[model samples]
Target: MYLTFWGVRGSYPVPGAATVRYGGHTSCVELRSDRGKCLVIDAGTGLRGLGKKLAQEFRKPDGATYNLILSHVHWDHIQGLPFFEPAYIGDTKIVVHAPRAAAKELRQVIGGITRHEFFPVDLDAVPADFEFHEVVPGSAFEIDEFTVLPIGLNHPFGAVGYRVDADGSSMAYVSDTAPFDRMLHKQHFTAGIEEPSDEDREILKTMRANLVESLREVDTVIYDTHFTSEEYEQFPHWGHSTPEHALQICQEAGVRQLVLYHHAPAHDDDMMDRIAEKFGLLGKEANVVVCVAKEKMTLTMGEVTNPGIVA
Candidate 1:
């Protein structure tokens, strides 16, 4: 299997000269099996490019079959779906797996992004055959040659991290989450709530434990490191982690490689360089290979090919 990063930015797309090196698109990743079965994670602006590529590759009579697994329904995560060209193709089959909403069905939640008022085309109007599945946290499911386990995350409106096992190798995607020690997010946003109750602490402890266990000894981990320690201190409830927090999880889980993902919009290419250098050194001390995620970066599962990380 191969894992490829199409988008790495967080919050929104930042397409400018300053962000060119690290890329400005929001969260979208593609994982493909040896048999060419593809599973996509998130549908941020980067999905636009991925869709174009898929449109070219799967232009046969049968069209393409792709499964999209979303961590959450944040605008930055699902904003590119309207621009995805494959959806306009009649034979394309897209199976979408997303976190279940307490009030809305999966279609209502995901399809809202492509409503007529927002986009020219509604999701229902698309030519593709779409199937929506509500992913339950802690439940394991199979799609193609992969086994996926959703790990609940600490985020407003709720989010999920995924553990994907394929071809005897494993990779975990943990994003849009805050440090478990700080704020506890649920159905509503918890921006100003700084302190947690005794019960909240226990829940957070369990949440972190589950996340670490899901990533235990995984081949690679793409984690949300959107904030610096200084920035995280100011917005502890923002539901984004720092590199330090990510490293802590990797060290505890005995992960082999740590990919610092979900770059903040404010972090320019130079800032990203500094982050890569700093955490790259820290990862060395912790016996893990660390590198910052860049757009178009591809990694074969169980192999160290990206030169950014010293093997």
Candidate 2:
């Protein structure tokens, strides 16, 4: 399988000279199996570009099949679905997989945003055959040649981390999750009205253990590193992680490579360069291949390759 980063920034898109190197588009990644099956990780603004490229390079007379796995319904993660060029093509088939909601169906949760009041085009009006699948957390399923495992993440309204395995290689994508703070998690569940019981601590521990096990020995782990240790101290409940959090997880999981993803919108290219350099040194010491995810960077199973600018 091959992995490509179309958009790396988190929160929102930031286009300017300051963000030119790392890019400004919000969270979207493409994974293509050796058999040519295309699986998209998120539908952020970057999906627009990926859609156009796929249309140009691979669109067939019968259109193409796209599997989109959403981490959550946050705006920055799903905003590009309405603008995805493939949905405009009549013969296209889009399969959207998302975590099951408490009340609404997966389709309703996603289609709610594309309603007439929010966007000019309704979800039903998209010129494609659409299917929505609700994924249960901690469940593993198969899509084409890839085995996908969805793990619940520590985020508001809940999110899921995905581990994809194919052809003896694996990649785990843990986006938009904060470091598991036991007290904060208890507060989240209890609305800050009371202290957590011992049971709460045990539940949190189990969740963390499951996440670590899901990531164990993966070839590449794309982690949410949206803050520095200092910034994380200020926004502990903001549903994002720091580079330190990422390194700890990767080191513990014995991951071969780590890709720092979901960059903070305010972190300019210079800031990112410094962070990457710092982590690069630490990665060397830890015997892990570490790189900050830049837009258009591509990685095959055994090697990291940057095709540079994607035209």
In terms of TM-score, the best-performing candidate is 1
lDDT of 1 by residue, 172-285 (tens): 899889989977887765547668889999999999999998999998899999999999888887889999999999999999999999999999999999999999999999
lDDT by candidate, in order shown: 0.89, 0.85
Per-residue lDDT over 22-121 for candidate 2, one digit per residue giving the tens place of the 0 to 100 score: 8999999999776557789999999999999877765467667889999988899999899898888888889999986467888888999988889999
Candidate 1: lDDT of 130?
A: 88
TM-scores for all predictions: 0.96, 0.92
TM-score of 2: 0.92
Clashing pairs in 1: none
Off by over 4 Å in 2: 182-197, 303-311
Cα deviation at 40, candidate 1, in Å, is 0.3
Best by lDDT: 1
Q: What root-mean-square deviation over C-alphas does model 2 reach?
A: 3.0
For model 2 the local lDDT of residue 115 reads: 83
